[model samples]
Target: MELWERKLKECFGSAVVDKPKAINNEMPGLPRYVSEYLLGFFCEGEITKENLKETNDYIHEHRIDAREKEVFKKDLLLKGSLKLIDKFKVKINLTKKKEDTIQMEIPSLGISDAKVSSDILQSNDRLLIDGLWGMGEIVYNEDNKQIQLEKFKPFQLSEIDLEELIEMREQFSSDQWLNIMVSTVGLNYENYNRRQKLILLSRLIPMVENNIFMMEFGRPGTGKTYAYENISSYSRVISGSQVTEAQLFYNLTTKQDGLLVQYDVLLFDEIDKIKKTGIDEKVKNKLYQYLASGKFDRGEVEKVSECGIMMVGNLPPGGFSEEELLERLLHSSITHSAFLDRLAGVVPGWELESLKDRRKAYTKHYGFAADYFSEIIHKLRKKNYNYILNRISLEGTTIRDADAINKIISGMIKLVYPNGELTDEELKEIVDIAISYRQFVINQNFMINKDPELKRTISYLIYE
Candidate 1:
């Protein structure tokens, strides 16, 4: 192993960091959190071939038997439930109090109502009820269909201790922290140059920020969709073809809040797949309105959800340079410049290094483990790194550039300085990468639209 990998192994260890199929997207059709919790809790903190096999064998040997179905018919059956904990979209129930009943969707099992306690609802964001099954109030109920939850514990990631967090923040240097973060997200620091690494981290920035919007357009095989899909359970990625207002904002059919309310990061993969008019004008307007200010109404319900939105698409590299591509895109109605302008930063997708080029890279050291780093990023969203941007003084820049600078700086806060501590020089290093992202959004628009007036507004966006 290289010195850094060896040092990381010694420092973090397998106990603190374990590979799970969930966070890596090695498993399909299940949420990342669900798979990770099962792996960590059941697989004994190792993700090797031997550990996985042994764990699977053990589970089959001890799982609930089919014969027990009769025994689970009476009393408060301790059945399965999916709880969003304190996190949820509200349903206005005139007859019942807000805390009394919440819907839990189990794929194999049917949805059930639990007469829940405030304590039970406040425990975790999402959980899979496990081990044994019973009926109402922990016993089998023949007549009542409701399942009462009796026992539960939050995963190591969802739970936090203030003293321990402060201690860890003080214990590690920023570089060490960055290296750990990279490895934890399943990347090897040895394989990437600084630029590739930054771009990789950029894909994750959406997950760590609230209400931030980003767009990345490039050729296929650049890992844009792969990055968003595997990173966290809180992300909801969809192909743009089937999107509708009901799906994006609220589902009139299900009488439920849409994807935005359920997830922390909403990713639209291959946006070019959706026709220009396929997205209703109302839906598009609502999205940009919420992007500008975090408020929207679905049916009779008006609510606010904090999530970062990411849009990805492919553009042919050879047909036209970005300058001409922008003109073609604007005129064709594939996407309007007005809608594109809503994005905080537009990623220059061609700049990212492809996964095929970096396939040989692997990390020898352990990081924070996949799920733990995800939870850490979620917690960091509550922090304000605006102070770092406030310290910056720029000359002859429009307010849009200023906003871009702030949002990009906020991304750094979530990824690099989650503990809200960093030196000025360290902040500057992050700022250089951030400014480049902002510059792309501004320069591309000016070049495509020939907005001489707009060009003058972003004189400071250019970096030589």
Candidate 2:
């Protein structure tokens, strides 16, 4: 172990368990980026007998694989069960000759078909599985061998102890947590001010909000896409002037899930450049459906997704007001008033407004490693905090305005109070921040639709 690695471990705590290593590409089916982030030390580099001992510790250590993988099963006769996470296409068969069998396919591995018990299929639709995977050599291709199912256990977060989580969190002060949060996304926390922290946090909002639609348009160099691009394997950021419907939603030819289904955070960079003439009407409509219903239909497939959608683009350093941005979006981009109505919030990244920014030689604050932080957020997202919305007075607000407010509030609750415990002042702080973010959406919407009440709601949020 190196000195820097030791310091990183101490500062970040368990958030960065291991350093990044080169990814193993020979392993098919599993997402390599995810494996590298979560299990990089073991999965990276060449396979060796000495390193295989670490793999054998699966017996002693309780940690399990939590990403997609191409499991090359060695023995078809093994009966023991193992846990793993991956996408499997399932089908049912109830032939009297056997109890029952469910067919599963890992298309990425060229495993066209395999069988699992009905128990595995019970929580089938929620593909974010955490269960034991039984391994068997069921079939063989030209070079790669197909794996068989021995057993599986779908993972879920049961009831949590609020006190225990709070006790654990108590070790760090608010400043420490804030620094850790920023550092987790690969930035030095001390380098940013309070406004910059909000900008950085805006990137984490997707993990906090359920299918929240967010956008940040600013001058190109403001690091708008920095966190989204480097922070997590759960996110995918696509940049282009012309985005096709099949590419984003679904592919009709291959029947493959698009970016919406595959990633937790789906970012469309250079959204300002996505011209109306360059986009297909169907792609635009599918985006609308995804925004409106948290899912989209492509022929026979209707994917229920929890993806947080974000749009990013370049804006001038000055002279662009909310009203002007609304007009520009309508004329230059595929997004319309109907589409704009579905956004949960908008971030004003240009507000950071630093002319002479400098990077520190080393990080002063320790934060969660990108992989560890991603998992912490993944779990935090499961918490319920809708009750916090009751704290807000919704008088004279439209339904969309109220819903947007709740979405942002929900984000803050998860970010600040993941343990489901907080003081009234703490709660107010979260709500006030949530309001400030959602107010941008309300004000933007008002500019487009000319909603007077919506415009006033922004003022109310800032004043109240």
TM-score of each predicted structure versus truth: 0.78, 0.67
Candidate topping lDDT: 1
Candidate 2 regions exceeding 4 Å error are: 1-13, 17-167, 275-278, 317-319, 329-335, 353-364, 451-455, 458-464
Candidate 1 lands at a TM-score of 0.78
| Whole-model lDDT values for every prediction | 0.59, 0.57
Candidate 2 yields a Cα-based lDDT of 0.57
Best by TM-score: 1
1-464: candidate 2 lDDT, tens digit per residue: 43444554654443453322222221233333343343435533334555545644532232323332234232222423333344455543444235334446654344545665445456444432222222222333323333454454322222334444445565555555565566555455566776577566766788656688888877766667766765555677787656776778777775566777777777878877654444566777787888888888989888888889888877744568665674574333344556766877778776754324434412444344444555566666677775655656755566776787677777766665565566676666666666677776666666667756556654233222
Provide the lDDT at 160 for model 2. 33
**In candidate 1, what are the lDDT values of residues 1-464, reduced to their tens digit?**
44544555565444254432434423333334444554665655457677666645543432323464333332114443322221122233334566543644322223344434446446543442121111112222346655444444443454544334544554567766666666666666666666566676777888877888887877777678764665465777887645778877877665667778777888888775553435566777788678767778877878698878887877755655765554443323324455556667767677755556544444445566555555667676776766556677656566756776677778876676667687766777777767777666666676756667546433333221
Query: What is candidate 2's CA lDDT for residue 193?
Result: 79
